[model samples]
Target: MAKSANPLPPRILRIIQRRRELGLTQEQLARMAGFSLSLMTKIERGAADPRHLAAERLLNLSRVLNLPFLHLVEDELPEEEAETPPLKVPLYPSLKEAQEKKTNVFVPLASPMIPLGATPDHLAFFPFPGPWLVGVGVPFLKQTGYLLVDLRPLYHPQGVMVVRFGEHAALVTAEDLTAPKGYLLSFSKGLPPLWPGDYNPELVGLVRKFLVDL
Candidate 1:
């Protein structure tokens, strides 16, 4: 009699193969996926289930492998278990505070810059506070409200600015400082702490710039 093939999902095999193709050790893959090496090893061995963000991490790994996202889920799900929803836990106390206050945090709408996708629930900061404009994406947007701002002018001036969206706010910055003063302005209408006609462009810009930079 012929033996039946192993029943693990394609995602598991893809993870194993992709890790090898990229020359990534399990430790490297784990760090990229925000998981521990032991956890990754367990999943590869089929000793654990990949649910919620685990699935997302697997998807991301597939991307790094240049494989199709659905390639990981090629097998039918077990009849008894349905796919789980994405986790919406807050990663910071400020997000929790914003949610408790029932206020929304404003964030830049850029897809790559926003970790929670197009519609985020937490307020996120950018440029991550440094000499250079480096930034980190986060997933705590579900706990706070979100908004997007256009920072084209600021980018030219190497200037920074702040703006409010619902109950949350963000600071934006540029890489150069040669842009004209007052060239940047908030365009969000009906936003609170509403910048009156006499708004302090420099101070507002500085405040918005520093908050996220920190």
Candidate 2:
């Protein structure tokens, strides 16, 4: 047999096997799991190691595959040390910067913060002042805190969204998306709404939940 370009890891093999048994194509699994099709292909074909995938991805994959999260993590753990760090998610300044791979840090979802279910793509924000959120028109979220966001584009529901342009990021009521020109962007009292000639905005995230505490 010709040598394989990418040797499949044991975990990758199992994951691919499970995907086949469930009759899910890579694109199907990627869409269902809220990730990119390209990434799903790389993982299933062993071009990427499953272990190195972000924590929430592994969790999502395990959940979809009917496998246990601990089992996947502990596969690399030695017998004497059974404990592993809690699953983690990354923090970014804005959805635009996140798309550019600019991030602040990774925060672990352990202890008190464990209940918030965030995807691996772009989880939460580094704590920003509530004033900015007010400017974005989300008065209810008017306090310095972390905001959980769904970074997957296209699949995002239209409405209150966090968006960025040039160098600014804020929450806005967006409509008329996909116009020949640009979307209609509105802001809170403190900020200006974007009109036709204004800077074209890029969607950073669809606001999922607000994390008021650190």
Mark the regions of model 2 whose C-alpha exceeds 4 Å error after superposition.
Answer: 1-85, 94-97, 110-118, 130-136, 154-159, 174-200
**Measured by TM-score, how close is model 1 to the native structure?**
0.36
Residue-by-residue lDDT tens digits, candidate 1, 109-179 = 22223333223443333332211111111222112222232222222234344433334344434421222
- Clashes (candidate 2): 0
- Model 2, residue 28: distance off in Å is 48
Global CA lDDT computed for model 1: 0.41
The residue-level lDDT of candidate 1 at 141 comes to 18
Predicted structure with the largest lDDT when compared to the true one: 2
Candidate 2 positional error at 127, Å:
2.3
- lDDT for 111 in candidate 2 is 26
Alpha-carbon TM-score of each model against the true structure? 0.36, 0.40
